[model samples]
Target: MAENLEPTPVDETSNRINTPFNRRNFLKYTGLTMAATAIVLTGCDDDDDDTTPMAEGSVNLGTGDVGILNYAYALEQLEAAFYTQVVANAAFSTAFPSALERSILTDIRNHEVAHREFFKAAIPAASRIPDLTPDFSAVNFSSRASVLATAKTFEDLGVAAYNGAGKLFTDTGNGLTYLTLAGKIVSVEARHAAEIRDLISNGDFAKGDSGIIAGRQIVDTNGLDVALMPLEVLQRAQPFIKQTIVATGLPTQ
Candidate 1:
């Protein structure tokens, strides 16, 4: 039944913009492939889940690894919604839309959708975060700077959250599989972060001047990066969620 939540249909032609594409450009921006067989299929029914609905109210994610995973899932839901809206309602210039810009947006949209779906599939029962209606009314879709800046914020925040939560994952209990998946997803998220950064300011690949200058360091190994724990990220997302989330699932603490 989880598959019932299919992504809203997209209007390709209307949203299309002519942008250039090159390996260097492609390397600069990396995101998940949007085209997938997102079909409704018979899966485990979560009808019996007792947790409150994500949109109606908040449910403490409980304490422990499960809680951390749930927290990450909630954030993913937020990012996905933002990108979905961006693709559905894109901005363009009077000149032929740049091929690079159009391709990047499309890829970003797809990546967000894939990440959202992955979380849903991983924890269908309790991972549905309330959908936040994006407040892009203030953003000029026609402006590349505005759009890419927003993208940078989301991507950077995502990487930080995952890094902070990685240590909390219980490798002993959940099996290494869970940790492996997290690493894979986080790597992809880091790629997104770097790409967004490049768009905002060329030659400004990594703000964090980590020793690993061989490549960009989107997320530095810091205790609490500003982008990592942004309360605004939560505030902008609160409109979609009605209740405060609590951490749950540890041995009665």
Candidate 2:
């Protein structure tokens, strides 16, 4: 029987549940995106003519499962950076009226903070993949529409990432453990996705009504989809991720 599960609130101190996830083991975005995008753009232009390059050694996140864990750690870092900026510079204008909006975003920030810290704690060795720098200049932090749209994109991407990466850790020692952890976070991510989408248009929330959902093709998976290749994920995430990723022992899905 598929057990009924209540989604854990990011703001709550506990997620004590009777499903695969509970506070005990399982635990844990984006206007943050334009802000991040700006940082990346500026950083790229800063070093105009440094040709001297040093030999860069691969930061081994270990083989098999270890590598997978590190992969997640890298992603968490990106999410954390984006949300941190959103929280740091939350701009509510007169047009956007909702005290609840700020509160909800704060909850999201806390969750992202927890996810980032969790990965850092779980994989100490891989945590050194360089702190990611974000660019938010493109966003008029003064506008609520820009912030929520960017937030929605990030929330959806995060869910897709987990859905796409869940199978890669299949043979590792803590494979099941990691999957459960992913499951826990994926639910929260999905909620964020829905909320942001609703904020855009409740009728279009998680659907194809809005241009964002209908325009872009999305393949949905309950974490049972084919695992995305490391190379592919890296490519999509490259623009936002400035860190060097060294991966090994990842299986083809």
Best by lDDT: 2
Query: Where in model 1 is the C-alpha error above 4 Å?
Result: 1-59, 90-96, 126-138, 171-175, 209-253
- Please give each candidate's TM-score: 0.63, 0.64
Per-residue CA lDDT of model 1 for 69-131, tens digit only, reads 556667776676666556556354322166675667667665566666555545555433333
Best by TM-score: 2
Model 2 per-residue lDDT tens digits across residues 192-228: 7777788877655556433323444343345232234
Q: What are the candidates' C-alpha RMSDs? A: 9.4, 12.9
